[model samples]
Structure formats: C-alpha cells, structure tokens
Target: MTMSSGNGISFYMPRYDFTVRARWLERNARLIGVLKAAVPTQAIFSHVVVSGQTVGAVTRIRYDGPGVMVPRVFGSVFFYQPSQKINLCYGEITESATVNQFAEVIQEDLDALRDLGSKVWADTVANPVRHVVQVNIQEW
Candidate 1:
C-alpha cells in the first residue's frame, strides 16, 4: 500500500493489512516520533539538525485524511521512499547512511524526551503520551 499528498509527504507499506500496525509502530516509535516532530504539517523544514549536527529536513504535503495523531500516527521511513508519487516497496528497506543519521536523530529526540520529564523506554510503547512533544529543529 502506498499513499501520497502530492506536496511532499508520502507513505508506503508493502501490504494494506494494518492489523499489526500497532506492533510496527512500537518497533519504530522513536523514528516515527522524530519524523512526526520534524514534520508537523504540510510544510518543509530545511537544514534539519540535532545538537549541532545536520540531518535532513521534514516535508509535509497535502492530505485529505484526518489529522495524523500520535496514537494513530502512521508515517514510514523504511516501508517506502519519500516521494511525490505513491510507491510501495513492500518491506523494510534502509541505507547505511540513513540508518546512522536516524540513530543520531533518535538520540536527540530521546534527550529531548528526557528533558521534558519523560522516561526513555527500552521499549517505546512504554513512553508516555503526554511527553510526546514535537521537536522543532528545522532550519526553515
């Protein structure tokens, strides 16, 4: 399954069966949170960085669906390649550089989570909802 907003934001999954979606979210909660925080809406934040290092910007596009929420949050970094057109890769895929970059981003997000009086969970599912604040580290 693949979805796009035509602006910039894109989502893709190999299968449409979101029955295990919650499990998937739990596995990648930090990544999701970071991306969600990085890209709050249908706008692009350029020159994204954390602690003083540059990562990548977050881009939001047009979408008719209901607003994306934390619990219902569904954006992917591995399932699909971010693009204007909907493209389904059908499985988890990632590059070495992307992985390293994400590691840094997750670390930064984790620190922010702690500063906000939130517990860093070995399992993200345990993270409190109240502390799931959006990170504003965009250059634009």
Candidate 2:
C-alpha cells in the first residue's frame, strides 16, 4: 500500500493465512512505535543512529542530515525476523522541506497502517479459504 500527501510512503507484506497475517501486522505496528521513540533530539540536519530489539524482532533506524546547506532529511526503519530468515517489514520517510516533517509523515503512515490491518482482517474473514487435499505416496 502507498500513500501520497505531499510526501510518499509505501508498505508491503507477503500473503499469509489470517492468523499469521494479523500477528505480523501487529508486530509491524509495534516496530513503528519503536522507531518513533528512537528519533533523534536535534533532528534537523543532524546525524543519528538508533537500534532496538524486541521479542523475535530487531529494528535498525537511522537519520542523516549532512549539513545545514542540505534541506533533506532521510530516515528508514528495517525490521527483521532472524528465525524466519526474512525482513518482516520496512518503512522509509523522506522530508525535503526546510522544516521537519517526519512527525507528520510517521503519523500518516501509522494511520494508513491501521487501515490496512483492518482491511486485511475484514477481507480474510469475509472470504475464507476452503480447500483440503493431502497426498501421501506409499512405497511397496
């Protein structure tokens, strides 16, 4: 899913059963909170790095602003599941304006995330998979 409001944010996840999907969605939301808490004190044109780990997940967040001459601020959060050997989720927010827009972007992303969670749940509940086929090969 992608949202464009003067800035752009996109979210993606692989298809899975409803129960599994819901668990992942909740985990992703929690990671977003972790990222927000890790925001640097002086975000404007500053270099900051924050990392945190939660149960079954690890997040790496970074904020970079080379100098006052530069007006762009780039931040990213990478959430990984080592046991699964895959990246559970990822989010990136960029602000080109002079002022800090990270807060607004994060808020928008969170709202969108909630919407997505609801949509996925509703979709799965409304239309559930109904099929069963178990094949067993016997050697004689």
Candidate 3:
C-alpha cells in the first residue's frame, strides 16, 4: 500500500516479509485504510507465505475419482507455531478423519522435527526415546 502526502507525493514504503505474532491489525485491514484517509501513511502486508504448519498429522490418502480408480489427497494439521503463550498446541487438521492423529511421535523423532516446538505431555512410552544413533569413534 502506498500513501500520498498533501503535496501530491507518495510516502516512503517498506515491505515486510516475515512471521509476526497474531496481531489485531491482521483482523482489521480496514483500519489501514482509515489511517490512510485521516493521515499520510501507508502499510503493506506482503503476501502471506505459509512457511509451514504444526499439526497433529500430515497424511496422504486415496479415494475413488471420476477418471481414476483412486485419487490422492494431502492433508495436514492446522495450528499456530510455537509461541510463548501456547504451551501445548493441537493441530486442527485441514479436514477431520483424513490424517492419522492417533500415531504418537516418539522422543527419538525430536531432532528431525526440531521446529515442531516442544511436546508437553507425561513422559510416557508413547512419547519415549526409541531410535539409537550409530557412531564409531577411534582414538589414535
């Protein structure tokens, strides 16, 4: 968004390309316009680049289709990224029952899913360590 000052010129514009915590402005784009009308300022929200999603699951399923015997559909859990307020997050998968939400992510899978934030649950086998690291060290 570009704003023009009284002299029939545009104000300096800046492009923001990054993730920002949920903000009130996100729900009110109209406020930006109001500010433009009342004052000489412009604000722009770069296209939303959905970096990634944290959910209960990501799944691929097959279903009957018109031309094909089975069609493939990709689904994921939709939820907010790990932030200070949300200690435990749940994924509202794109559609219910499409993804496998029952499967548990064992502790060993932590490194691979580092950005998965942190899992806050009772330290039970369902989320216990399983995988082992293979290493051979030789001292000379």
**TM-score leader:** 2
Q: Answer with 2 or 3, whichever has the higher lDDT.
A: 2
User: Residue by residue across 1-140, what tens digits does model 3's lDDT show?
Assistant: 33232211121212111111111122222322332243332222111112222312111212221211111122211111222111112222132222211112233433333323222111111256532211111111
Please, what is the whole-model Cα lDDT of each candidate in the order they appear? 0.24, 0.26, 0.21
* lDDT tens digits by residue: candidate 2, 39-71: 322110111122211111112343342212222
Ordering by lDDT: 2, 1, 3
Best by lDDT: 2
Q: Where does the lowest 10-residue lDDT sum fall in candidate 3?
A: 131-140
Query: Could you tally the backbone clashes for each prediction?
Result: 1, 0, 0
Candidate 1, which segments miss by more than 4 Å at Cα?
1-24, 43-140
Worst 10 residues of 1 by lDDT: 13-22
**What's model 1's TM-score?**
0.20
* Candidate 2: stretches off by over 4 Å: 1-9, 12-78, 83-105, 129-140
TM-score of every prediction relative to native = 0.20, 0.23, 0.17
